[model samples]
Target: VRTYKLDTVLLILKCTQESKGCSWYIRAAKIAGSDFFSVTRYRSKHTCSRAVQSSSNCRRRGNPRLVAAVLHEDYPGQFDTPVPKTIVDVVHRRAGVTVSYSTALRGKQLHVSDVRGTPEEGYRMLFSYLYMLEQENPGTKTNVQLDADNRFEYLFVALGASIEGFQ
Candidate 1:
């Protein structure tokens, strides 16, 4: 198993058992001035193999939170055109776990959908904003652009104000 220390930014590896005199462990420290970690010390051999179980129940695929965090950190601006393969690679590199294409795609979909609500909800919010503006200021002009599917495309609001002495 592996553990992370956010305060020190160090990764620690140790035997599954916590008994004393167990010399199987490794400590990795982050190198300064670079995004790399070096193993400070390692025992290489293990004597607690008998105590370890044969079967494992831990997940091999990256979890949803981990996938989402990696994608958000790696692709902050590429949400509109997210590449699933690229996300998969990022997750593997950052978390030391390989995720399938479908997992990556689902993670991106969840993140994007959360940020950009459904088409109906988006339109409702847009219309409410337009209504608020019109009610607050009389004679305000608002224009909305819709796509072929009746989804919101663009918004233009004129506050009935002159720009550079021109209306």
Candidate 2:
């Protein structure tokens, strides 16, 4: 359930064993002037004796989008993309959450695509960028190498100002 006051928003999440008076619940409140949230009250121990604490439902699951966002925060402007195993390890270590390899791969791919545009869109924008560069800077040399099927393979550019400065 969600309850909010004039300056604070309160959120409460309960376990499925609530019918038996389980104390497993989390209560968090939003800080007044910031995007941060603080957990004011929480109970990790469940009172009910149904052996549900070890179940999958009781574990916290991070979705693909949440994983992507975490990756962005953890590794800003990162080089050397992390593999699925590394992604899982990082999430487990940092967030205490276990994610599947498939999910981790999807999240990493999503974050990478968000940072670097998709291949089709990138190729489309490359022409526009090269044209603008050549037009704005006279003597700017640009070359695009393509393969047999007319696909992008390589790109080379020489800025006019740089060439002039070199000479």
Candidate 3:
């Protein structure tokens, strides 16, 4: 048997498990669509097909709340951390580029403490977190540009690109 990490185990359980109200994949499909497979493409080239194939059986299994609960155990942040405005200003000043949304939300201040981690470390962590968020809420456009320093930054949250500090 393939040994899975806690997150993977929870993901499989979430995407494959079912319940009376709805199954894991059914709900996820509503959010992620049949291309739920595409989300897992990085894990394995065949993950998409396998995930879709297993989705059917998962619907019969009943109740994915447990899986959600399990996944939550691993993912404590609810995407609640606010993307700070200072970071956004720094990004704009450093990048010498205007990220779309940042221009609009310029006046609205966000607390840096909420997303206060090392710039590079936070960059990677936030990317993974937002990637998962993209899987859950694939609603926004993601655009990326490099700063004058050549550091990467992202546009919208749904777009899945990293923002050096741009909100």
Model 2 lDDT per residue over 1-167, tens place: 11222244777777666766877778888988986679898888878785555444446666677678778888775634689889888888878878989999898988887777788898889989999999999989999999999988899999999999999
| Best first by TM-score, ranked | 2, 1, 3
lDDT string for model 3 (17-136, tens) is 223222233111122433122233222222233434543332222122322222234334343322434434434554443333343233222222222445678777766776677676
| Candidate 1 residue-wise lDDT, 79-99, digit = tens | 563588887887888899988
lDDT (CA) per prediction: 0.73, 0.79, 0.37
**Highest lDDT scorer:** 2
Return the candidate ranking by lDDT, descending. Answer: 2, 1, 3
lDDT of candidate 2 at residue 133, scale 0 to 100: 98
Worst 10 residues of 2 by lDDT: 1-10
Error of 1 at 139 (Å): 5.7
**Superposed model 3: Cα runs more than 4 Å off:** 1-115, 147-149, 158-167
RMSD of 1: 10.2
Worst 10 residues of 1 by lDDT: 1-10
Clashes in predicted model 1: 0
